[model samples]
Target: MKDILEIRIHGRGGQGAKTASQFIVEAALDQGKYIKAFPEYGPERRGAPVAAFARISDKPIHTYAPITNPDIVLVIDNTLIGFVDVTKGLTNKGILIVNTCEESSKMKEKTKFKGNVYTVDATNISIKLLGKNLPNISMLGALVKIANNISLESLKNKIKEKFLKKIGEEKTEKTIESLIKGYDEVR
Candidate 1:
């Protein structure tokens, strides 16, 4: 991780993109890192494309603006590849993580991204582990793994802390399980 790492996450409105961003920042905060998290919405509807931003730094963050050039980009919805320029600001040295069954080579052809790309089947992981299509929690696992700034244990604990009261212990465990699978299975 660099002195500061900025991340951009792409997903549909109801896909939990905002939640993922908050989780990333919250976990980073738990590590005593300065952080920021926010969302950008196109339409106010459920299926509309949305973007979320998370900034993590070891020192005090001075910039409050949206990340124009992110260090890492995470696409929670593969359908937005063509519809949205998810790689618009990613550098050749940056990392791109996508939630899809497609290979990285295929993604490179589609997105024309020259950076290191990682593809993970977060949907299937969530379905198998959480019994739902909630890719947000599992995607957190991939985010932490690729970013390498936030600890996986910190993230899982954060999720548990946030969801334990709202979703209970059983569902929280499933969410953590999906996240772990995504962390281990991303390629």
Candidate 2:
């Protein structure tokens, strides 16, 4: 991972973008990595666009400003591509991950981004495993694939620890399965 791997996640309200950011930070913390997460509410209403920022590093972090040039960007909802500048500050060497069924090539044309664009059907993965459309957790699986700072086991264990009681064993297991599917199926 880079010394500082900054990430921005875009999604609609209630889509779990904030939760995803928290997950990333918590998992990184478990590995003793310096991290930060910030959630910016869009319209103060559900269904409105929202974004969350996360920073992971090997050393102590000091920056408190918003991430303008993210090393990676995750779009939990593909529909926000046109409405939000998902690739606003992403560079040619940076990575862009989106929860869409579209191919990377097509996404490149749609977003006009030349960097590495990865697509995962997190919506379907979540619905199939969790019986819902919450793709935020699944997006973490995709992030795990690209982020070397945190191991997959660490993320899964963290999720299980955090969600087991609130969501029960069955649903928590399903969520983990959805996350694994997102990890394995990202392209």
Candidate 3:
């Protein structure tokens, strides 16, 4: 890995892409790394395409521009494949993680992506655990598996601190379950 790791997340407005970016930044910060996280949206409404970027490094990150070539790409919505060039500037050795029920090999074939690939049935996991289709929190688990820069324990703590009070106990527990499932099941 380089001194800096850049990640791009793709999803729709209601899928929690922005929140996932913030959680990643918080987890990286807990590891004493400097981080930046921000989101971009074509339309600031539910179901509109949204992209979030995060950069983590040992040193301070000076760049504020969008990441053109990311070290990792997280696709929260696989349907965006045909609508967006999700793999536009991924590095040759970049890691690609997708939230889908499809097999990783099938996803790679469908996207015509030729790098390291991982897939998790995050949507199904979320639906089973949270009674919804939100996969962002679960996707964080897969991110931790791929990045390894942040500890799952730290990430879970952050999640508790951020979501426990806001969403209450049961929902938060389900979200954590989704996260752990994502970590265990990604391939």
TM-score of each: 0.97, 0.97, 0.97
Model 3: how far is 6 from its true place, Å?
A: 0.1
Clashes of 3: 0
lDDT of each: 0.89, 0.90, 0.91
In model 3, where do residues sit more than 4 Å from their true spots? none
Q: Across residues 107-187, which tens digit of lDDT does each residue of candidate 2 receive? A: 999999999999999999998887789998888999899765688888999999999999899999998998898889998
lDDT string for model 3 (7-124, tens) is 9999999889999999999988998989999998566999888999999999999988889999999999999998888898986698899999989999889888899889999999
- What is residue 76's positional error in candidate 1, in angstroms? 0.4
Give the candidates in order of lDDT, highest first. Answer: 3, 2, 1
For candidate 1, what's the RMSD? 1.1
